[model samples]
Target: MDLSQEEPADWWEVEALYDLCFAPGRTALSSYRLRDDVPPVAQLCLCLWDESDALAGVIRYWPIRVGGQSALLLGPVAVHPTRQGEGLAGLLIRESLKRARAAGWARVMLVGDYPYYRRFGFEKLEGVQMPPPTNPDRVLGLSLTPGAWTGVSGMVTRATPQAAGHKDATDP
Candidate 1:
């Protein structure tokens, strides 16, 4: 498999892949409520491809604020059913975070399993809060820079930046 930046042409396929990989009502979940209003963090979206060029996995990030502090929100990492356990998801997480850091983003947060995400430097976010109806235990975060999460408190809200429209690796 090959890991590459996702192009706009891949967006529809990626959405289909996510639909198939996740449950039917996945988008309505409380955690996903934030996604409906924010654009994806184009620089951080990654795709994994198989030999035939089929999308095997995908990961995306979005701009968000915690207590008015800028941060990236990672989510909806989906692996094709046939390609599970090949480490594509983890690879995407690492590569995307590397790109995010290189692009000057200092923090990222996600609602996910603590055990799995901890390997990627994510820890319990003491000062971050997701929209209501989200489980506290699933809320986690990581710092790309030293103490990036320090003093970042309050509800997680979407931040719509004008530069967000600019192209990054993931753009077509």
Candidate 2:
């Protein structure tokens, strides 16, 4: 398997992989409502490829504000069924998070199972909130910088209009 930043054209394949792994109603979840007007933060994306170059897994991050605290929202990580249990998902997550930190992002949050994300330093977000219909227990966060999450609290929303267009990194 190969792990690296995504390539522009690989996005379509990643989207396909997501469609297959998740139900069609997946996007209707409350967390997605916040992303309606926001574009993803391109720099932190990572994709995994098999020896034949077929897309095996993918992960991406978006910029959002929790109440007023700026943070990255990681999501939509998917691995092809045929490649499950090979550690591709973890690899994509680890690499993407490394990229996120290198780019100066201090925090990240996600709506996912606590058990799986805990390995990456994500813990329940005490003061951060997601749109309705989302269970609070599943809302997790990680601080790339030590104590970065201290005092950060509020409802998470799409990034401000100004930062929406600011993108410093992209997949090769």
Candidate 3:
């Protein structure tokens, strides 16, 4: 398999892969609420392809603020059914986290199973919260910078429009 930074041109193919892996109702999840009008960190989005060039998996990260501290919200990583158990998802996770740290992001958070993400250094975020219907236990975070997650706790809100330099759907 080959790995590459996801480009805008890969949107539909990536979305299709997500749909196939997560099913059509994925958008209704609480994580999607955080991303509703937010733009993902383009450099952190990644795609993997097989030798035949078919998309094998995809991952994305969006910007959010935890108590006014800038952070990346990692999510929606999906591997093609055929690629399951081959570690494509893990590859995407590791690569994206490495890039995020290099890019100066202080922290990253995700709503996922503890056992799976623990290996990546994600720990339970005791005081951070996502919107309703999300199991709080699934909220996990990793500090890219030493002690970055320390004292970082609050309602996870969408990053300010000025920070992202673009208007969100809620903007008038």
Candidate 4:
């Protein structure tokens, strides 16, 4: 599989992949609340293509703040039905996390199953919260730098540069 950073032109294709993989109501999930009007971390947004050049998988990370500290919100990773058992999802997760660490991101969070994300070093984040209706147990985080998650707790909120000066709606 060929992996590359996602380009702007790939938006619709990526969305289609997500639609095919997830339920139609996926956008209404609490995780999508944090992504509203926030741009994804460009370098960390990735796409995977098979030898046939068909898009196989996609993953994205959004900028967010937890207790006013910068971090990333990883989510909506999807693999084509044909590539479901090929480990393409894991590839995207590992590659994107590597890039995120090298990009100087201190931490990353995601709302996902522990059984799947735990293998990537994600652990349940105590005192950290997502939007309503989300299971607190599914709120997980991984530190890229030692002690990065230490003392970080609070609601996850958009951390876009444009919102830097203003208190985030989700901030406590």
Across 21-136, the per-residue lDDT of candidate 2 in tens digits comes to: 99998878887776677767766778877899888889987788876767888888999999898888888888888888888888889999999999888899897888887899
Residue 110 displacement (Å), model 1: 0.3
Model 2 ranges with Cα > 4 A deviation = 167-172
Best by lDDT: 4
Model 3, 33-145: lDDT tens digits are 77866677788889998999999999998888888777889988999998899888989999999988888788889999999999999999999988888899999999999
The clash count for each model shown is 1, 1, 0, 0
Task: Give me the runs in candidate 3 sitting further than 4 Å from their true place.
Answer: 166-172
Regarding lDDT, does 1 or 3 come out ahead? Answer: 3
Window of ten residues with lowest summed lDDT in model 2: 163-172
| TM-score for all models, in order of appearance | 0.91, 0.91, 0.93, 0.92
In order, the Cα lDDT scores of the candidates are: 0.82, 0.81, 0.86, 0.86
Of the two candidates 1 and 2, the one with more favorable TM-score, higher being better, is: 2
Please report, as a residue range, the 10-residue window in candidate 1 with the lowest summed lDDT.
163-172
RMSD to true structure for each model, in Å: 3.0, 2.6, 3.5, 3.8
Candidate 2, overall lDDT? 0.81
Name the lDDT of candidate 1.
Answer: 0.82
Query: What number of backbone clashes does candidate 4 have, counting pairs of residues 3 or more apart or in separate chains?
Result: 0
Rank candidates, lDDT, best first. Answer: 4, 3, 1, 2
